[model samples]
Each structure stands twice: as C-alpha cells, then as structure tokens.
Target: MRDTVIYAHRGLNHAAPENTLAAFAAASRSGVTWIETDTDILADGTAVIMHDSRTDRTTNRSGSIYDLTTSDLDTIDAGSWFSGDFVGERVPTLRELVSFLGPHDLNLNLELKGNTQGRDRSIRLVETVLEELRRLRPGTRVLISSFSPLLLAEVHRRTDAYELAWLVDKGTIGEDWRSVMELCGATALHPSTAVVSNRCVVEEIRRAGFGVNVWTVNSVQEANKLVNWGCTGIITDIADQMVEAGRRR
Candidate 1:
C-alpha cells in the first residue's frame, strides 16, 4: 500500500493554538511534512491565516474578520484562548506564514474561507491569496481548497500552478460530485470524515484518478481505515500521534 500523507490540521493544534506560528512550528518540529491551515482576506486586503469569518473564537478580541485590518490584528491575542503558554501569539499573515515555512521542507494546504458578502469579495480574496503565494520559494508544494465553488472556479480561472481541491461536507457533497469536481478543475476532493465513512466512496473517487483527502480525523483506527481505502491524505489535529502511528504501520 502507498503511504498516506498526514497533514497537521491547523498545525499540531492540540499542542499549540490553531493557525499561529507557534502551532505551525510545533508541527514542523514533530516531523510533519504537510500543514493544513485556513486563510481569509482582511479589511485592508491583506490575507491572514484564520479559520473563521469572525475572530471571536480564536482571538482575545471579538469582531468580524472583515471589519478588522492588518493593524487591528496586531493587538489581538490569537493563542491565549487555547492556553496561557501562547498568550502573546499573533495571527500570522499569509505572507508571514509563507516566509516562515520557506526554509523548511513543508507543503501547505491553504483552505480559502469564503466571503459571506458575495462573489466579488470571494474573487478578491482569491486574488489576494494568490499574490501572497507568489513569494513562496521555488519547488514549494501548495494546494488551494475551498468549500465555495465560486472561489475554486476563480482559482482555476486565474492560474493552474497549484493543485486545487474542493472541500465538502456530507450535506454539500451531492451525487454529482464528479461533475462538480470537473467544473472546478479540482485535482482532489477534501471531504469530511462523515462523508467518507462509506468506504466504497473512497474507492470510487480513487478509481476515477482523483485524490481523496479527509479532514479532522483524530483517531488512529479511523486514520488507518481511510489510508487502507486509498486515501491520499489525512488532515488531523494530532499530528505527533498520527506520524508515530504511520511509522509503526
């Protein structure tokens, strides 16, 4: 069997705050080669690494990410919510993340958080992210994923340099998955674990020559099952445990 890739979902997030440089650094130090994180554009048009459209959950300050500029993000503490150890952690911009991971042999799976406002904003978000990625070192592997079909289509329209993956949950992934994938020109499908529980689904997608990557998989037993069914990658919160388990297998 081919070895399945393990991506530290939001960087060894269980050990450090999700989406912070400290979390990413922890993942890197633990021998994880791939890191999966979210990105959204700020009010100032700067692309920042954050999972939510709002900053209430991950930061000390409460506000919509759309309402906050880069300067506003400076005072917000992104890591303290998770633990006292990361009290001063700031949200890393996409530019900052790329530069930080530039020296390491790490791959990035950047999930574009959709703009709730409209398509124009979503397109702009994609544009801003692409511009930031241009600074990545040559030979760095990157995958752009989104739950928004419009965003994926925009990425396909703009450039074919990076691999694109369509992120879908059980409800969003319809029976016409193949058609949807073709429409977005996605090389892979990132489905939630709930959707991939039916093993035949994984078999079907892999047989069609497209990669399958699952999200939020924290259990080793579940991870093994997916890998055995030809999963291309497993995005997990427990990177250290998963890596050791993969080694034992």
Candidate 2:
C-alpha cells in the first residue's frame, strides 16, 4: 500500500464531539497531519463546523444550525448527546480551528455546506470563510471541498491558492466530474467510497493526476481493502483504527 495521508473525518468525531475543539484536539494529539470538517454559516455569519443542516443529531437541540447565532449555539450542549463526559461542548469557528491547529503542520480539509437559503447565501458564506482563512493564515495548505458542484466551482473561482476538491457521488464521472472540476479549477477529487466502486476507477483517477480522498469508511477490513485499492488519502471517523488496519498488512 502507498504511504497515503490519513485525515480524521470531522476531527476524530467517532470518538469525540464532532466539530468541537475536543474533536480537533484529539485528532492533533493522535498525530494526524490533517483533519477534515464540514462548515456552515450561523445566523450572525460566523463560520462553524458541522455536517448536518441541523444540530439535533449531534447536539442536544433541534432546528437548523444556521438558524442560531454563535452565542445561541454556545448555549446548547453539543457534546452530551454523544456521551456525558463530553457535555457542554460548543461548536467551533474556522478561526478557533486555525488557532487550535497553528502549532502543528496540520492541513485543513474544509467542506463548504451549501443547500441553504436562496439569497446568494452559499457564495456569500463561502467568500466570508475564504476571507477569514486567507487573513488568518496566508499560503495555508487549506483544501476546500463541497458536494455541490456549483458551489465548489464558485469557491475555486473566487480563490486561486486554496486547493479545491470536487466531491462526486455514484454515477457522476467523466463529463460531469471533469467539467465541474475544470470550471472550478480544482486540483483534486473527493469521491464517496460508494462511487469509486473498483480498482480501475481508482487507478484511472490517480493516473490522470488528480488527488483522490475517500470518505466516512468505518470498518477495519473494509478500510484496509479500500486503501489497497489506492486512494491518495482516506478520511475516516474510525481513523486510528483504520490507519492501524492499513499498517497491519
């Protein structure tokens, strides 16, 4: 197997609170070189880390994360639902993330969450985040990705330095994949494991010179098999376990 990078999916989220300082700190301490996270804009235009539209599943509240201000979000217990020891965790902003990771040579695989309001909100939100990232750390090795092809394109167009990865799902390759990436000026591809189906596609994408990072793989056996198939990197919740699996053979 290649010496591919192992980035914690949402910052050791399977073990710690997802998108919180606790999660990121665990990933940093675990010796991970990079950590990936989902980002959304709150009501006060603060960029926060989270995967879903709402905090109900990961937090002790219901309704959309975007619907709340940063202070409002701080009030909700973000960690209790995961485990009692992790209770009272607050959602983290991109700035907080940069501060937490500044001491290490950690890369940020920031995912922009779209599918929001119809008011150019997605682009505006991304622009704000990009500005923050650029201001905090110039020439930072930040790789921004997104499931929305259009939004991904917008992010790439607006920024020239940040590496962009287009996240594609099953049955979306060739024209749709290349076209969107080309339009966005993306240098990488982040396809879901379900989409990359076999070794042929994996080799093909790599041979074509695009960075390939897969997502959310949990099982050791399944993860070991995927790495053997040759992805440039693996993003996993069970990171330490899967990385251990990769080393076993």
Q: After superposition, how far is residue 214 of candidate 1 from its true place, in Å?
A: 0.7
Measured with C-alpha atoms, the lDDT of residue 226 in candidate 1 is 88
lDDT of 1 by residue, 1-249 (tens): 127888999999999999999999999999898999999888788899999988899999888988889899779999889999999899999999999887867889999987886777777898899999999999889999999877898899999999999999999989899998989989999999998988899999999889999998989888888888889999999988999887886
RMSD of 1: 1.2
Clashing pairs in 2: none
* TM per candidate: 0.97, 0.91
- Count clashes in each candidate, considering only residues at least 3 apart in sequence or on different chains: 0, 0
Candidate 2 residues 1-249, lDDT tens each?
238778788888877988888887888777777889988888778888888989789888899877888778658888998888897898777778877677765778998887577556786688778877865455447888887777877776676877888877786655566666777777889888887789998888888778888876777666667778878878888777656655665
Candidate 2 lDDT at 103 equals 72
User: lDDT value for candidate 1?
Assistant: 0.90
Clashing pairs in 1: none
RMSD of each: 1.2, 2.1
